[model samples]
Target: MATEATEIEITTIGRRTGEGHSHPVWFIREGKSTFLLPVGGRGSQWFRNLRNNPTIKLGATSAKAKLITDQAKVGQVMDEFSSKYGAADVQRYYPGVDVAVEVRDS
Candidate 1:
């Protein structure tokens, strides 16, 4: 949730085409790492694309296209994201749907 409105960028892969897609998201930093909580949950195109392939491009002012995944790091990721973005927004994401979270390398 700690952001500067500087246009945090994240590129996700297309599940079927092996293509790359980019999105300007609110990239949040916590401690020494960073995370991106899809506000739309698994149903999100970006989230679904990520589920298909954990590898994607993560960038801020600088770009570090890396392979990221959802591997049981949700609690920590949620903590940081919720701390800044507020538990309401993150929780509201797919409310009653049990959303997913992941850490992206920056």
Candidate 2:
């Protein structure tokens, strides 16, 4: 993964349609894991899709996703995002920080 890139395209299977859907999302990489924050938290369409199917694609890289709902863990992921994307920008763009997604290499 390219650490310098600010954003990456994530492809997920639609919960209802069972079809592929791709969207640009901001992410932060730490060691072997990648963290992502849904713009609308658990309510985001992508997040909901992941709940049904954890499989995903970060650009061309296939991966598995785990939803981080624990408050403490989500906070840590949020902090990482703030550190990388700037606090102001994160706060402005991500209003609902109730959940996070952790992506690991497959």
How would you encode candidate 2's per-residue C-alpha lDDT over 1-106 as one tens digit per residue?
A: 7888999999999999999999999999988899999999999999999999999999998888999999899899889988999999999999877999999865
Highest lDDT among the candidates is held by which one?
2
Separately for all candidates shown, the number of backbone clashes (residues 3 or more apart, or on different chains) is: 0, 0
Error of 2 at 13 (Å): 0.3
**Candidate models: Cα lDDT each:** 0.60, 0.93
lDDT of 1 by residue, 9-94 (tens): 77878998888888876556656555666666557788788777766666533333222344455556666666766788767752
lDDT of 2: 0.93
TM-score of each: 0.60, 0.96
Candidate 1's error at 38, in angstroms?
1.3
- Model 2, stretches more than 4 Å misplaced? none
